[model samples]
Target chain A: DVKVTQSSRYLVKRTGEKVFLECVQDMDHENMFWYRQDPGLGLRLIYFSYDVKMKEKGDIPEGYSVSREKKERFSLILESASTNQTSMYLCASSSPPGQGSSYNEQFFGPGTRLTVL
Target chain B: LAKTTQPISMDSYEGQEVNITCSHNNIATNDYITWYQQFPSQGPRFIIQGYKTKVTNEVASLFIPADRKSSTLSLPRVSLSDTAVYYCLASSSGGYQKVTFGTGTKLQVIP
Candidate 1:
């Protein structure tokens, strides 16, 4: 089975602090994504990486940044954490890009609940 | 990018079939329709995906019309545990880029 593991299940950060959320997948998938889920707003994509050292901004990428230094690891960074950034962050991995014989089904991790105070 | 719209909520009883429809008026020819089911505080799970007419799997089914502007997700013999939010996504690989969760249809199963 493919396993996507997030570094933290919950985290609390002070305002203006630098925050890092790490995600690692055991399977060597090429596509990885970060999304923050908020009530009413639903799940908004933050960033996605199709290959190592390659990244693309998603719908809500203003306050967030992502890194894909290696194929098995992807990281989401908050340059200056704000209170509004508090939400449930989910990490997911998919097979090679455009290879969603089933429309790019993403296998997700449990998620990290971050609270910016 | 094509935009998707779905109902806010729905109600259904156990053992009944539930169908949730989503509208994507600007869908392109190559766009693929996908459905996801999300539980509270958890990430959404992929249910089904269809490009043309009908696609069925062990969990759910997807129905797309010839116009490709709308799609329906049908759940067979839904149980109480099946209560969750269903999201409709339309993507055409590259052109249809943005993926928005625009108010997915939340299904509440009643006993």
Candidate 2:
């Protein structure tokens, strides 16, 4: 079985403070993603890394960035945390997509609920 | 990536089968349908994936027709633990296309 773990389950930070949320996967998957889930708006992607040192912006990438220094670890950085940033953050990892196969199933971690005061 | 639409919520009883349907009228030829289940305060878990016809796994089954415009996820039996949000996503293999998740269907399994 694949295991994806996050650094924190709950976090609280004051406004204008910088925050870091970490995620790790044991499956050595090539793709890693970060998303923030809010009520009614659903899950919105923040950033994704397809390989080491390679990152791409998702739908909602403002005020957030990501790091993939190694294959097993992916980190999400919040430059200036605000009250609006309080939400559940989720991390997921998956193997590279095949040429013609529809096997891009992503395995997710338990998620971290971050609260900005 | 294709847009998917599903119900907001559903109700079911224990020992009863639950089926959730998702519609993707503009699904492309290479797009595939996948379902994920998310419990409260937890990440979404992969349930099943299928392109056409039917595909069954140990946990659930996916049924798709010839047109592939929609898909149905069938849960054999329901339990209290089965209550969660089910998200249906449409994705294709190729470039780096970000997967979009809709509001999803919330299933409340009552005893």
Candidate 3:
């Protein structure tokens, strides 16, 4: 079974404090993503990394940044946490889509709920 | 990425089959339909996927017609543990495609 693990299940941070959320996947997947889920808004992509040291901005990347130093690890960083940034953060990983494959399913980790106080 | 529409919520009884339908009128030829299940305080998990016609697995079945405008997910003999939010996604294969998730259908299984 594919397993994705996050560093924290719940986190509370003060305003203007730096917060780091870590994620790791054991399936040797090549693609990793970070998303935040909000009520009514659904899931919005924050950032994604297709390869180590390579990152791309998603739809909502304004207040967030990501790091992929190694293949198995991807981290989300909040330069300065704010109340608006508090939401459920999710990490997902999937292998590159193969030819003739119907879909490339993304396996997700247990989410990290971050609260900026 | 293709836009998807699903019902907001559904209710079912234990041991009954549940069917959820999703509409994607503009689905591209290369795009595939996928379904995901998510529990409270947890991340979403892939349930099934299909391009067209019918696809079945141990957990669920996906039915897509020729026009590909809509698809249905059939969950057999559901239980209380099956109560969760179901998301339907449409995406093209190849490379890294950014997927957009809309408000999914929440299924509540009752005794």
Name every residue pair that clashes in candidate 1.
Answer: none
Indicate the worst ten consecutive residues by lDDT in candidate 1 chain B. B91-100
Superposition error at B95 for model 2 (Å): 4.5
**For model 2, what is the alpha-carbon lDDT of residue B26?**
92
Quality class of the docking in candidate 3, CAPRI style:
medium
Cα lDDT for residue A111, model 2? 94
TM-score of each candidate structure, all chains considered together: 0.93, 0.95, 0.96
Runs with alpha carbons beyond 4 Å of true place in candidate 1:
A97-100, B93-96
Interface root mean square deviation per prediction: 2.7, 1.4, 1.4
Name the regions of candidate 2 deviating beyond 4 angstroms: A99-102
Ranking by DockQ: 3, 2, 1
Write candidate 2's Cα lDDT for B44-109 as tens digits.
988889889999989899999999999999998989999999999987765557889878999999
The lDDT of each candidate is 0.87, 0.91, 0.92
Best by DockQ: 3
